[model samples]
Target: MAGLDDYQFFSTLREKDNPFWQRTSDDRDRLEDPMDHYRRPTEFPEDLRNPAHGTPGPPPTKAPAPTPKFNELEGQKVNDVQMEKYGELSINIVSLCAENLLSHPFIVVRRQCQVNISSHRYHVLPITIVPALLHIQSCQGFSAFWKGLGSVLTIKGITLGLEDCLSKFTPWPKDISPHSSIKTIGQHLLLKSSALALITPFYSASLVETVQSEIASEKPGVFDVFKEGLTRLLSFTQPQTGRMLPVWLLVVPTVTHGVLQYILGNSVSTLTSKLLRRLHRNDQHRQGAVSKDSGSFLDASIRLQSAFIGHMAADVILYPLETILNRLHMQGTRTIIDSLDVGYEVKPILTRYEGFFDCLNTTIQDEGFFGLFKGFGALCIQYALYGAVLKFAQVIIQEVTLALVPPKPKPKIQDPVTPLAPSAPYTPSSIHPGISSLHTSPLPPPRTPYGASPATRRPLGYGSPGRRQDVDMRAELEKHKSSLALDD
Candidate 1:
């Protein structure tokens, strides 16, 4: 009986391992008795379950998905990941510092304006405002940093990746491969799509969220408050027809800015950058001649020169585009906050300016050519100084990075051939062992001139001596010198 029980236990164990039984078991585990679509644990209808016999509750809303994890240190091990994360953290912290330093001035000015400081001032003097615009708040700095981060990741980074892929996949002339025009168009598409997908949603939310209302209302003048409020009117997924102007601003103004930047800003910037770099190079060359340090503006002076010039020109000269863009965003909106008094009447601002071109034409016709540059003074204060600070901040960050992470000491480049001095002493390696061993004839020692003794041998400059009968080399040299002296 015990043997039989053992056999039964063994059989059960073997059955668990068997493919057929395993499949059966899996099927059994999966299988469940059929139930009603709206199944309840009590086996009752909603009407029955409810003591009041009320309607059923709607299905629970799905919670937002958990953020996905990525291999932050994807290169290798846990230690590697930690190192990479730390490096990235350091860079981000440095960038944050830069952003804060650069943008805080503008934020402070706006804050001052909010507080009704110098209330009557309509047109701020660029000189006076530039200094004020230099200050950045911690929050404002972080906002700018995050905004820029979003811009890069969603728009620029994606565009770069797409462009790289396209450049690789698409065949073209070797010289003009990954054509600039084509890439620019793609960039526009990517930028717009990115703006719509990423920026627009956040922007739309920020509009109705009442987050900036405090500052928006704090600015002096009822008209200015209204204008700011109108600018921040609600714009969700289904923005009203009149409210669609911000969309137009997002599309045309950005594209126009890009076009202008490419044509005017880039050319001037490049030209300026090149000139500055050339000058810097010249200065460095002079400095190197004088001192051994050879320190230019920055360690990577070329990059710094380009960044500063390009960024400065864009911020200062191209700021008018941003003003126009804002104006465009303001146009075509039907909703008006107007005066709080019921009796007060407000003029309809823009009936004809229903879209981008219309708004642009209207601005030009009504306000003159300089109308597009309405905020030019403010922009000069904001962008110009901000740009200077930002670029300088970048330089500072790079300098710090160089100091701490100190770029992999650039490989010591070996010269193609170090010219041997004419007076250099001949070594054993200088002698051609094969050539020397080939000849059994007892000639001058290896590397020594043939027919020349080591004591009287001329160094490298005077050509190799031909094999000859044993002779006094010094005597010959002395004789030649005498002959040359006599000739002179």
Candidate 2:
């Protein structure tokens, strides 16, 4: 009796009269509930309603939920990302310094070679790298090789750091597509070129400091040299009067070099990467299977090599311009440089140029086209050594850093498993004692059609159309009884 009452109570809870059931429009309007903010039209003042039935009121407003705050773990993750970026930046700077330090001698040799000219009096024709290096060693000693190294390092480091910092604030585009429009490419090139051009004065100063012969009697500090270079760069005095070329003259060449170098380097890198990928794919097809680790390592190697190759190619192509630029930097500075020796006598620049094209024309006419690339061999050797040293240093630093501070392992997440309830075993029962118990399996549950639910499976008398008829339990029991009696 209690079980029957409980069932009746639950069944009644689904009826329209139950308070828990969803209210209809008319039923809600008829009710007078203080808690319900959506009041009936009659309760409102006449001015608020239409002439007949009032228009439906707007839905009740909801307060927005508070935003979730970052927890400690989330904050830690963000910090880690920032730290990683800083770490990579530091590593690159360190590697750059190391590379420069190791290969600076070659730089000295190259600059000297570039500035050296063949005169009829000295007959210093066919100036080569080995001879030039030996001459510097004999005359200026080993220390002369790094004469302007401090200025170079300072300029390069500051420029690299400043550019990186500014890049964050700059509205430079990211992840540009290969088929990007001309406008986008122009914007990218313009922005990058401008950044480089802005630092042209400093670069010119560094170049002047580099090409100037070391003064033994009164050695100037790095900062002093740098300041002097700046002073000379901004002065408009002629070469014979002993003043460096004006900084403005180098702007066009610097910007042009920056833009062209960027374009050529990227183009070469892209082509190299594509070629490598094609070869890799062909090899993979033939080999059938390759380990992911090996493939990833291969990709890293390819990128590093491609970048190196691109930079080298750009440098090679632009060597003439660089040589001319170096010469221009030394144009007004009448310092006796050890590298420009003809018959063991130091020589300074005697020619003056009006502009970049004028300098280009003068250099070609005076020494032929090949003369512009005076120290090509030294440049190549310097770059090769720099690349090798930079890579080695980076690897060593990263390995040591990892050894000192290993990465923390990620936390494992295990989902909660829901254990299903055990189903009861099937047992048949006889409907009638008179009929001998004939074993028969239980019938399968009725099939529910697609999109059908318990509400739609109610008896036909229910208000809903397209509803199924409910099964009659009593009729099914009587059918079983009749079947058993027939067996008897």
Candidate 3:
């Protein structure tokens, strides 16, 4: 009986080496009943009691199925998945554009108008306006007016046209509107009133170029002399950027200027009016009313204030463009802002600053918050002149074009010039290429070549007649020299 008990007990134990036994043990440990033939016990005590008494289970079990590993992927499925993801990505980009427009129109406008200020002046306003205003304002005087106007119109038309052309390419979402009423107002101001002020720089730079040429006969290129002069100018102030004039460092001066103008406008006028009233008190008591001239000083002060503020606002608006363009010109890239690299990779000339916040941060980091406004005085002067030149050029060009183009007569077919054989040699004419050189001829109208009407030549920039290179060079030298003197 004891031997039988031992056999039964041994049979109950699993063979440790058997794979079937191991898998069975794993299943049991994992609490998996593969057969599903019996209900689980309610308690551990009941399970223990039934462990020996449960009907003898089938001998162990085979091992669980091995997991398969596949080497090849379904190329078609993968392509489909990728395509789906690309569509999703497109949707996301569209959504982002829409959301961004609704939430941040200022950012869009900011990209359009970058305010440029120098490093030497801290007190002046550093805000920079657009370029169109300069073109408009430059038009003035006699034959020069229409030419200048035409130049400005051309530039403005080109810029706005470019913007419109690019709008279609912008991948904005369905819900987004990059433009806003506020932005439109800002744009108008920037394109017109603000832009006019910035034309001065072209004239100023031209002037400087002129001076440089005059001096070049006796000295090195104006650039070299300019570098030396710039260094000398910086000797009085610590320059943050190696070659830049410390002109941008005087923020206080700019502030003082603006403040002075503001005070001159509103406060001065009010004070003048009050004083004038005191003087007129006796007159009022005698005549029951003061004369219109009683507040003449105040009236003059008010008028002066409006003119000063208007001129100042209008003047400095495009200073940033001038500053940027000048810096670029000095560095040798005249037409475009960026280098040949990707947009983000292109470094701005005045990378000494990133933005308004960056400037303020640098000021605080290097010399406290006060340093942010450096060069305000120089900026005001720089911007005022910069805008003036740009405007002057536009005005001049329009005027010139108008003057040059003769009034068109109704088209009539007259005797057209008869062409000689193709093998015939051409002869040069004595007529000069410019409108200024054209003689007023009383002779019958010249025969049209190929029966084509004479095309009216439009004015070029600033309504100035196209002169010989030597003449242009002389003018440029004179202008440069004048600017250099002013800077000194």
lDDT, candidate 3, 207-315, per-residue tens: 2232121111232243443344345344435444454334333223333333344334444445544665565577587888765543322343333333434444533
Kindly list the per-residue Cα lDDT of model 2 for residues 1-488, writing each as its tens digit.
22343334333432323322344466667746574556532244435555457675555567699999867676665655554455466555655565578778777767767776663222123334556567667877888778778888887776666556556777654336799888877666666776676677677667766766775224557586557645655553332244456667777787788778878888998899889877887898799975453323345556655776787788889878877777776676565565343325566656577777888898789888777877676777777677777577557755654555546657788998997654442223323333222122132223335788887643222332222234344564465455555556
lDDT of 1 by residue, 381-479 (tens): 655665565566556654654465423334579779986545333222222332221111112222444787765674332344333233444554465
Q: For model 2, what is the alpha-carbon lDDT of residue 297?
A: 30
TM-score for all models, in order of appearance: 0.39, 0.55, 0.20
Instruction: Please identify which of the two predictions, 2 or 3, would achieve the higher lDDT against the true structure.
Output: 2
Q: Identify the candidate with maximal TM-score.
A: 2
Candidate 1 vs candidate 3, lDDT winner = 1
lDDT of each: 0.42, 0.62, 0.35
* lDDT assessment of candidate 1: 0.42
**Ranked by TM-score, top first:** 2, 1, 3
**The candidate that achieves the highest lDDT relative to the unseen native structure:** 2
* Candidate 3 residue-pair clash tally: 96
> Where is model 2 more than 4 Å wrong at Cα?
1-99, 119-127, 161-181, 215-218, 229-243, 291-299, 340-345, 387-488
Error of 2 at 157 (Å): 3.2
